[model samples]
Target chain A: MSSLKKSFNVRCRDFIHAGEASISVQQLLKQMHIDPVLIRRIAICGYEGEMNVVMHGGDGIYCVEINTDRIVLDISDKGPGIADIAKAMEKGFSTASDEYREMGFGAGMGLPNMKKNADEMIVESEPGCGTRVRMSFIIKQSTPT
Target chain B: MVPEYISFVEKFCTGCSQCVRVCPTKTIRIRNNKAVFFDELCIGCGECTRVCPEGAVSSSISVIEPCMKDKLNVVIVSPVLYAQFPGVMPSDVLIGLNEMGFDHAIDLSYYLEMFQYAVDEFVLENRKSNNAPWPLISPICPVVIRLIVLNYPNLLDHILPLRRPVSLLGDEIREKLSHEHGVDKKDIIIYHITPCHAKVVPDRSGLMDELGFIDRALGINRIYPGLKQKLEQVKELELSLFPNEHFSFVPSTRGPLWGMSGGEIAGMRIDNVIAVSGVKETMAYLEKIEMGLFSDMEYIEFRACTEGCLGGPLTAVDRYMAKSTVQKFIKMFGIGRRLPRHKIRQLYDKGWFFSRIKPSELAGVYKSKRKPLTFDDMKKIEKLMSLIHGSDCGACGAPDCKTFAEDVVTEAADLKACFKMKE
Candidate 1:
């Protein structure tokens, strides 16, 4: 029933500081002694989400919530939102510019990769306003009674 | 239980906390003016042994001296041994060991070549099938194996299945001597001239110990003096008398280089392989790999030692000098020997080199006895963290303030231990 929450700031177009949030989250999960497979899955989703925010969104917030039974990641960005979520979810459908593409930033696999690794994923966006993504992973019962 | 390979001399320890700072696993703590090690948390990287200026940290030496008097002792010299003597060829070192009363001295390079062939074929097949994990990690360094077992269990499958060349050579030597020479298996003792203490762990733990080929591990520094004396005498002998062709074991151009960092990947035929050395570097790279990065890499060779085995804590010579000597030997002994492809293929089919490591075997090694933290525990830790100054001074015996806060909350340490609290 008890849950812990932490948040990290992600700056748009900040290639240098990208992935820092996910790395911190990964380290925290390791310290909590979570199952390595679960940690890796969460790490992949966190990384993909952070990269998405850096490339597509304006300034954003990456947050994590942890409890005995599950972990949830909420990433929200204030930028021009996607007009068609379904098309954006398709593979190889990157809207990244040539500059970002050359740097290997956007291959259009970000949302799909996150979805693949997370047990559940939800996306909400208003084209003129902003976007938010939520991902959750179920933690197996590991703590002794 | 794994044997205690590293020892702390209480008299020599100044409690300066250098070892605690250098320990990759944070297994050491300065308690009561001496360094104490938690056996379970130790990955045996020997970083403390290198950093302890007081010579407080020392690896356990060979116990085979008394037992070897009656046995047919055969020494298996690590390639790092040959690099220790700047001018002496590996054959001379073998001869020197013979003079030092060993029945036979075998160079590990022969088995290193065999290991390379097997790995090459295995990589090729795995590439074609794409069934196994990509970027298979080298299993040569026991410390690296232990690190994966403790910290990165998810990457356990990334370790190559082949038995380490030393283990393979130990088995082959024991079998050959007992079967062909008619020596009793119990009487034929195998002493590994080890460059590091980590090599001592595998002989006692995991799948590497199932065969029980190696009887003991002798540090290079321990045996250097006697070998050097014999080498001085052997150096005077005519080069033509013990020519390269006359020696039973001669390494190929690439085999001896295996003791150097990046040497393993250098010999591999694959193009997408990477080689990383040093504990910190390996750990950082592993973090990246766990994040699902480097998908295109076919292989990765990681050595816990900075300059590979030559820079091991037990070595007597400077790592840079040893590296140069290894290079000189390779140049002198240009392209010496090769295992026939057919022979390697046959052994590969028989699964002769495969060694499986089960992560389940290492289950409790890294586990904490305390129960998982609850919401209240987290809130308490966060509050304590805010109260403490964030300077990571090791005066509290913990690695950093964050660890100190966790320890205090877990009842592992007292809040009074924080020197800053008194001020």
Candidate 2:
């Protein structure tokens, strides 16, 4: 098989289970016996995406595709999209309300952290049309078994 | 290596997956109408033994026989044994242990007290350096150590590297007995009387191999009948062997407390500590620690058994009664110290209280063992998963629907095994 995909539903402001999706994805990759380094990257970026959906998105779907050579994460949400993707991509530029701040999150590091951790990142948003963030990580070349 | 303390009896197992569901490591799986164990992944926590309705799981506890010519037998009693028999005096147990044909029976409470001191000093040293990871995890529970070594390698650095109290006591007793008897060190056999099954696994480090300090570890359940008989004998004779310091090491007031949950932290006098018991709760705590949730915490004590060592599968008494008995015993005698802090400090500074284990090297092997899921297999698994009812009811002899689906796709299970599918 070329690839396998799994999708998770992220409800907005569900702080009770904020990182549940990322954990599930992480566990799945672990069960697959992926390299620890790759699993760590996936966990960090996936959790950042999951937290973003719970904190900012009205509703979202987090999809992970695992391929022989690479893994892909696509986070799409129905919410007030970022008008200036460039500005929101900067570190410490979050627009989170006081409640989010009180929960020790929304420091504006989510997008930047994801971008820094992933091999490549893509962002698209239409202010009111919602936003979609996609990230791809190259599976490190392995010595042939 | 994963220890072989807990054995699965295939004949008695019904493939209920009760042990599978309760296994924190997910090492037990149902295949061919039987529960199979991945020994490398098992931590020997005895959770399987606890949940096996068919009585299929049993632990390999040590059984000490009488010493032959030139062999010196010494029994190192578990601190938890004091809590095993209700209304039984601590001295009575020691006397009973002696009556079992062992030359000497030593209480571990003294070693436990020393261990507490060592722990406090180690934590304080870490606090001063501020270099080690936060929330230093306790390594007293062999099962917890195995869990971390197998599953949580990253947190290995956070585990306090001290040797178990019993190991230290084993070393000391062997040396003392050999010297006093003018006998070869090999002639002295030290057997640890234990309440936990995990203790039966030999400490296979080079030092342990060389010294053979603790030759065997026997569960209290194995000796409880003999001990009960001995206790009756002592009561009938009205033996006046209280504080048998001449015959054996009397436990200091605080060490036996290590038998219960939170006892280690309380004994160490640590200010900020979180004590969690039971395999599930310990695993959850570990996950949270992995997520950096307990960064502000100082210490975490994770015991595999529900009520700590007292709740071990090999333990003879109910956990609550044991806890109360321990408390009452401590109250009746009150607290006393066998050695001064300065002496404990001397031992700590001499580096005699810690394990020489290179945790990363030893535990690092358990990683990279997860089987890779092929893309074709993944698709089939996903398709099968989607077709199944998502209740995760575990009625199909697998832990959940997803696992059952995977098993079916892999030809390890049949599709008709699903009740919903039959409907």
- Please give, for every candidate in the order listed, the TM-score of chain B alone compared with the true chain B: 0.93, 0.90
lDDT string for model 2 (B266-365, tens) is 7766687889999888987776676555667788988999989889888888899889988887787776656699888898999988788745456465
Error of 2 at B204 (Å): 7.9
Q: Show what share of the native A-B interface contacts model 1 retains.
A: 0.56
Best by lDDT: 1
User: In terms of TM-score, how similar is model 1 to the real structure?
Assistant: 0.93
For each candidate, what's the DockQ?
Answer: 0.57, 0.37
Q: Give candidate 1 misplaced runs (Cα > 4 Å).
A: A13-17, A98-105, A143-145, B1-3, B62-67, B202-205, B239-247, B331-337, B356-371
Task: State the interface C-alpha RMSD of candidate 2.
Answer: 3.1
As a whole number from 0 to 100, the lDDT of residue B319 in candidate 2 is 91
For model 2, state the Cα shift of residue B349 in Å: 3.4
Candidate 1 lDDT for residue A94: 87
Model 1, B1-423: lDDT tens digits are: 222768767899999999888888877777788887767777788888888899888777543363367778888888888888887667778888887888877777667777878888988998899976877888788888878877788887788878888788888878888886687898998888888777755433374542477877888988898889988988886444343222257545465588899887776667888889999999988888888877778889999999898898889899999999988977787645476878989998998888765434654455444555555767788888888866888998888888788778888788888986776
C-alpha lDDT values of all predictions? 0.80, 0.77
Superposed on all Cα atoms, the candidates' RMSDs to the truth, in angstroms, are: 2.7, 3.9
